[model samples]
Target: MIAVALVTGTLLFSPVLATHQVEVRGTAVLSTEEVIEAAQVPLGVPLTRLPRATISERISALAPVADVRFGQSLPHTLIITVTERTMVYQVADRGSFHWVDGEGVDFHQTAEQADGLLGVLDISNERLLRDVATVVTSLGPEVVTMTTKVTADSIDHIVLTLSDGRQINWGSAEKSAEKAAVLPTLLGMKAAWIDVSVPSHPAIK
Candidate 1:
């Protein structure tokens, strides 16, 4: 009976463990105020009873959020950690562009161009979009730094344009990992065009 009463009082009546503040971290494109408002964290509630699952669900509903985690500090604080999506490329529509992540999700739209990320021009189908995204995501920093744009008429004919006006014919998304692994070294060779369509027998001319 003593233990039960202690538990009940600590959980329900204790002011020391009550939520006094909410702290949000790991946000890049989102504002701290935005996450706090969505969480709707009840003030003065006991830390253990903060409805974390529901709060997580609400925050996850935000388009930029890829994942969210919750925790509580012993005295009087609630902690929310978020993992935002990694935007890989941009696709133009009228005057604006949609920011697409590695998973091919169009999460954000803006009129200004994103620096360092490649722009995709001719990808027409959803399947091709995902395929090209996978290929672009697999590429190393060296390759991406050199690349200016990506284009695909079909899923099987993905292409990357270099800053120096060179092309890399990345046939399909099938062997992307292998192709990416070999690209840094391949770019150093004297070649007219590079093809990693078949990574095992890559053609460079």
Candidate 2:
């Protein structure tokens, strides 16, 4: 009975189990204070009683956080690890531009244009954005650096405009690996336009 009481007392009031520190990791664009504020972690609470799900839900509400992980550093600290989303594409909307990640989530808007991101023209549909993302991600680094913009009026009519005034009819996002494999060879040809939508029957003009 005495041991049971001691255990209960320790569980309820032990300073060793209280959270005294918070460590945020993997933050680049987001500040530590921002993550902490979003998490709203209950400091001084017992580490075991910390509501991890609630903390995660709060942090996940932040636009830049793609994923997050939580851990308790025994005796006094809580650790938050974050994976931020990559800004892969930019789409013009209402005179401002919005940045989208590979997951097709439009996370932020900027007044100034960002360099080195694929400019998506005439597209606002989320599904089409996802398809564009798939195509962009599938390209090799060599091809990606030469490309400037992507446009798709419909899922079946995707196009890539290169920096050097060349065009590629990339069709739908399907069979991307096959398309990517044949693109370099097509680029080597003396053509103004290359069509690899049906990679099985590539055409050059």
Candidate 3:
């Protein structure tokens, strides 16, 4: 009888301990404010109402939010978890800088520190964004950091600038997976630009 009474007491007390709490935790690749603003979830909504899948879907609408995970902390408390997309290039729209993700979505930054990012200019279309993102995503982390900007003349052809002022010519997005697979080997080469448009036969200019 005593043990059963204690167990019931714990369950009842558990709700009192963690009720009415909500936390939003996420990496702000574009900006935290954007994520919160875009979600537009109602304040004080119960954790149960904050459907995990629904919230994730809504959050994904934001270009910078690559992935999101949400859960309930207590009856009334909810926890939001998010993974932000990496900033591949900052497209100069007009005069201001807007961060573009692999999907080619534009986002506003909340801090001035983002100014030092690699500036990708002369892009006025959506097709170029996907093309650039394809190349940026294929390359490994080390190679991505070396990239400064990617300008696309056509969907298949793109030019990438490196930190050392070198240029890279990427042919077509068709063979992007194959082209990206060989990037690790190409990283060792020292040239003005490494062309991965043709993985079987690459031309260094």
TM-score of each: 0.85, 0.86, 0.67
lDDT of 1 by residue, 98-123 (tens): 78889887777778887756556553
Residue-pair clashes per prediction, in order, are 1, 0, 1
Per-candidate RMSD vs. true structure? 2.6, 2.9, 4.9
**After superposing candidate 3, which stretches have Cα over 4 Å from the reference?**
1-21, 27-60, 110-124, 181-194
The count of backbone overlaps in candidate 1 is: 1
Model 2: how far is 129 from its true place, Å?
A: 1.1
TM-score computed on alpha carbons, candidate 3 = 0.67
**lDDT scores of the candidates, listed in order:** 0.85, 0.87, 0.67
The segments of candidate 2 whose C-alpha lies over 4 angstroms from its true place after superposition are 1-13, 72-75
- Give per-residue lDDT, candidate 3, residue 19: 34
Task: Compare the candidates by lDDT and give the number of the best one.
Answer: 2
When 1 and 2 are scored with TM-score, the better candidate is 2
Estimate the overall C-alpha local distance difference test score of candidate 2.
0.87
Question: Predictions ranked by lDDT, top down?
Answer: 2, 1, 3
Error of 3 at 134 (Å): 0.5
Model 3 score (lDDT): 0.67
> Tens-digit lDDT track for model 3 on 1-205?
9999998667654544343654668775545666666666665544444445765687788766777877765556566678777666676655566777777666555433364335454556777667777677777777777777676777766777778988777776677778777866776777777887778888675
